[model samples]
Target: MAQFDVEAFVDRQKIGRPQLAVLLVCLLVCFIDGFDIFMVGKIAPAIAEGFGEPVEAMTLLFLCQQIGLAVGAFVVAPLADRFGRRSMLIFACATFGAVTLASVYAQTLFQLSIMRGIAGVFMSAGLPMALAMISEATPRHRRSTFIAIALAGYSTGSAASGAVAAWLIDIYGWQSGFWIGGIVPILCIPLLLFFVPESLKYRTERNPKDPGIARTIQRMDRSVVLAGDEVFVLGEADGTARKAKLLDVFLEGRTWMTSILWAACFLSMANIALLAAWLPSFFQEMAGIPIQRFAIIALIAYGGGVVGTLTIGYLMDRIRATTLIPFYYIGISVALFAMGQVSFEAPIFIGILLFWSFAQTGGQGGLNTLITQVYPPRMRSTALGWSGGAGRIGGVISPIFGGVAIAQNFSLQLTLTCIAVVPLIVAVLVFMLGRNSYARQAVIASVVTQRGTA
Candidate 1:
């Protein structure tokens, strides 16, 4: 057997316990983030009834939160590089948690919308920071699996929101869902403080000669290392370290690639946001099922997402992120179209939604992992953040647009089937961009290999 270059392979290889633990924390936070976002959709009917308003009222609230996600990911994540990942996470989580709790007392739809938006500002930081921390901590080769697993928590949380909302509404009220959403994150704060260590890569970059570098490195697991070096020595850290700039994403053949990735994100998420926002309503209105029944279907879809994410993550490492994504989108488009045709039979329509959920939701982690690996560590968080922000734009539009189609009394089949085109277009874009992404990565690898050899 040909021997593998252990160091280059190490970062991309399978990870261990500590890395997984931190990933779980990130996943848990993301889970909460997912729940917060999905909760509104699950409880939309209740919220509308409670506020004595139209479903459109909830759309405004949903849009506000998504807008916050866009702004936070685009604007706030870059700042994390300067301020420090640990500090940013601490502040972000606490703020989001508090705002989420306060939302429980919101007296009107307008007030709740504002509170949700404010909460979004904090929750938005969770994924980018978590992914950044995991990217820095895990070996690059194995990073995708760790990321997929963490994001799985997100899907699971979204799924759980349906059940939880149903139970809470029956017992306490719709407000209880928000209360739990807010309070659960508070628990993460202390876990973040206690168990989740600061990114060693971030610390080393901040001050190579700060005298604390050695201590930080020594305290970390010995398995954690850079791609090529005797070891991750502080002063000798990769000369690639520089002030992370957003502009860096536009340089050296990356300008077009960034745009393409952004487009892919936009389309992929549009459907995701739409489905989350409208599924329960669709089931109630079109399928003539009770809202609680629809919630079960949503849970099934979410479960499929978890499985899809893990499966896709494993495949991405072998097949490469670029190659895996286009097919995933195409699969989602097909599955969604099929979903539009099926009746509410237990195995058919539900199965179609599961397939749609599996492909689309799983592709999310694949896309983010691709972005994280493509960018240099200096700009990794910023790239991830902005990409997420771009996706949020799609998310912002998807729900409102879907709501309009439904409100205008469009047939469910026509509305959902037409929506599938968005992902298909995204699939084409992803194919082009994936090819470009691979070529760029190949060039980067060849250059680095030559330098090491020299």
Candidate 2:
């Protein structure tokens, strides 16, 4: 054999036990990340009451955590290139876990807000690193499907937070939730350090001489033979380039995609953050339901997300994201507007909300997987991190926006309709992107076919 092209090898091979183990670890990490972020929203009412404060007073916690996410993703995610995704994830999880545990003792809203922000600093790292690891480990054709499945853990964890809180909050109060959230991650630290694999790209780039490279190649498939004295990759992953620069995301004909993707992330994350932060309150206030039951509504929404993510992931592999993403946003806009008009009957509102979740939440997974195809491995984590950071800016604003809408006493219908407009605008932007992104699958295919055949 002349040489081994690692990217080409992974793209053309079947995923095995090692890859499956990686996917599960990534899924578990992201699931915990989701659980941590959603936990605050679920327990908001309980914390507010415990602190003797109005719900509006708790908006600062949401705002700060989002700001932390932005700062971490924008400023810290690029460190993965230099430091390794495995190291970054381990550190982030440990720090976030420790801070979360400390939050259990927070005596005031100010203290809790600070702790939440600190937790966010590290929480933002989880998705970027996890996705980077998964993308590098899995084969190209199955990338989206596996990513969707790994991400499904996130939605599941978010839903579990509500159910768990519903069962535990009354008996042990808000602190109980924090205790659970914190301890599990701390426990996960050792597992991550011991078991979670490093990115194959990262290892090869860091040192082409790394023996792990051959092992990683073997792990991707058992059938390949490298009979040559030396093994090396063909192009961007050949260990010659410096991957730490953030500006790389804006180059290589990627300026347009990056810009539009950032916009979509911002709008979608804002709207989703708003719904996550305020919907429970809305259900309790408008539908006159018990507070704990509102979590069931959120759970239903997230359950639809599982179906939605997998469907979108499957379709994007066939249909171009340009067509899929814009239409998906349009569907979310329609579903959300319909949700506003539904009668307060629990089943009906939840069903429509599920439709909205299917479109918007599932569409988000599609965008994430689509993003992986556009950037080479060098740029993947940073691009994902920046897009996540950009979206989190909206997250930072959404809770305050929701608080203002509530404090000003806007009707639920008006609020839902107003928020629906954001996604419609996103649809138009993506439509322009679709026009520019023609033959994207062809580009992705070429990235693979350009490599030599055995």
Q: Which has the greatest TM-score?
A: 2
Q: What tens digits encode model 2's per-residue C-alpha lDDT throughout 1-454?
A: 2455667666666667767877877888888888888888778888999999999898898778877888988877777766888888778878888998999899999999999998888888888888888888777667777888878888877877877677989899999878877876677677767666787766665566666778766655667676545446535444453546779877767788789889988888888888776876765665566767665565667678889988887766566666778888898999877877777564677788788888987878877776776777766788889989888888877767777777787777887788889999888877776655432643446334423221
**Mind giving the per-residue lDDT tens digits that candidate 1 earns over 276-386?**
668677767766879777666766676788889998777665565656787888888898778768777757877888888788878777887778767755667787888
Q: Each model's C-alpha lDDT? A: 0.73, 0.77
TM-score of each: 0.85, 0.87
Q: How accurate is candidate 1 locally (lDDT)?
A: 0.73
TM-score of 1: 0.85
Model 1 misplaced regions, further than 4 Å:
1-17, 45-60, 221-241, 279-295, 407-413, 437-439, 442-454
Error of 2 at 370 (Å): 1.6
> In candidate 2, which residue ranges exceed 4 Å CA deviation?
48-57, 107-109, 219-223, 227-231, 234-239, 280-298, 346-350, 399-414, 437-454
Candidate 2 TM-score, true structure as reference: 0.87
Error of 2 at 331 (Å): 0.9
